[model samples]
Target: MEGTKPKAGCPRAAGRVGESGMEGALVWLIYQRAPGVGRRRMAQLMRTYPDPEVAWRLGKAELAAVRGFRPDIVEALLAVRKSAEARRDAERELERARRAGLRVLCYGTRGYPERLAEIPVPPPVLYQYGPWEPDGRPVVAIVGTRRPTAYGLAVAEQLGRELAQLGAVVVSGMARGIDTEAHRGALEAGGTSVAVLGGGADVCYPQESAALYRQMRETGAILSEQPPGTAPRPENFPERNRIITGLSHGVILVEAGERSGTLITAAHAIEQDRDLFVVPGPVTSPLSRGLYKYVRDGAGLAVSAAQVLEDLGFLPSAEGPLHFTPRGLTELEQRVLGWMGSAPWWPGDLAESSGLPLPEVQACLTMLEIRSAVRRLPDGQYIRIG
Candidate 1:
């Protein structure tokens, strides 16, 4: 009894601590629902008022003067604060997250991802499960199509393994296909990987990936901008992709069709000015075409793990000589080679016509042309040689 201090009752001590954290949390809630107050606009308001809690209480006239400010945003901000039902719902969500051993970090908190703060459209709040270590090595985002071929899986696995070996942490959307392969490959290689979710961090989409989601939470983290219990909506994905790229040092596209969402992530990477890498596939293969366009447009070509490392400036130079190797080729390469006609073929035309990985098809054609198995005309057309 002499060494022990008397226990304080719940109401006074707990209330003071809660009150200190509550204002910031409330401001974050207001920011999340503020319709037109995006990252830049919110920064503007925060700058003008110097306090988000005070800014949230600003009258319509005060908010209207801010750049890109809108009437609806002010209305939404005020309405959420005034609505008892909305407040109740938010409280329920918070309680549910607490029950699940999760934690929420608003944009202005010490726990918020620092890298995300640099983005133009940073999420005002981030909901996370498990530990988040931004300083933990380099985080590389690996993304691709929802329906990946076995070849894409192979490439993703190889790259992930190499990335892990290099002490890089992999990040992805936790989607099906190539995204799944990337995370799985990283974990299989005994590396860490983060999954940025389109829904609440607690809710796993493609519900079949629940096990993977659990694995990611234990070994890495599951992150989201939405509060817990938020359903998966179409709009959440595009918004979520930014965080995936924002949290990484670079992004690697494994395989993506012309209109793949992975391309959205690549666009975000470019906008964020993070390094971008693409694996080129056959023109005929829907998955590789989108990636080829990125590669041809001066994006780093993911020929091998060392190229990725070199392009990222992690390695001083590429490991070996600049030469082609046949061991990298798959069965699709042999088939595509044997079937080409004597007529000339465009890289796009040939790949689309041959049904191979665009990069693989392109690599083979380049090799064949060099070996006289084919010839490249002055017009950029390819022709079989005698």
Candidate 2:
């Protein structure tokens, strides 16, 4: 984040894009709802029509002439614009959002999150419900599987707590498992946590999280690109993940299965060039498999919050070195544990590396897994958890 200055016109150069400018932005929010329409097509529209307001007035035949415009989607767009209903609907929703204490961050205007502007399809208008700071404080995303093991949950909460206490804003999807725990931890530390929703910023999908939602609304911030009344659809999550990555200084994967939805966020982090860290967990647990793979593939291995803080140039100072206890570990298990680094390793490779028989190496790994000292990966790799 060093030397990363906020862009011009992002509240530093001017004021928020007024209601009139919002109309220009509203074209995107409404058009994207049409099937197969997205940021790319919207970009095309802006180029083809030059003025968003003029594009909004285009008839079906005019729209069809644009390159890459689909026949089916053109009709959908025409339907929404039929009698100017879509424009009115967007206007009314924008008014409702303002009445509900939400702020609209119009694209190409003042007050949008600066980091998001660097992404490919930054939301045209973000429905936000709290304060925004573009003063260069690091924003770290803590995400994991929705159904995590006890260890994964614990690590996520701890990471969130420590990061917030050390002066970083925690960014997350506000999903059921790890995201919820991370947000709670940030709140526990009296620090801000930004919740990016897959649905409307006004809608809290898991009704059980209502209390937490209230806390965030009062203290942190809740944002969404979806329209005011949109429901939580399955397809909404991947795009939501992109926003999470788009808004962070880095990302932490506490745990993930091979097929967990959290992988979507991880992929976005890579594509966005956000630094990634993975917390190792028990190999026998499916929740930890993807994390081990990430570490093996060159993601940073996170053993403590200080490691991340130091990498971010937060000047973290550790009090003491981490110590290991082998009181209950068999001699072979202890030796195998010693051989394993923070990086993940396979038993076959470990056997060769440690000069032990393959069967003996496998046995030691199972012992370590049972003791919660090593985690098993989906592809039979292992990593030290402590």
lDDT of 2 by residue, 223-269 (tens): 89887767899999998999999988778998888988889898989
- In the order shown, the candidates' Cα RMSDs to the true structure are 17.9, 15.8
Q: Which candidate is the best by lDDT?
A: 2
- After superposition, the stretches of candidate 2 with alpha carbons farther than 4 Å from their true spots are 1-21, 30-36, 43-83, 313-386
Cα lDDT of candidate 2 equals: 0.75
Give per-model TM-scores.
0.70, 0.68
For model 1, residues 59-159, the per-residue Cα lDDT tens digits are 77887777666788667766666665655555665666666666666555455676777776777667787665674256788898888998898888888
The candidate that wins on TM-score is 1
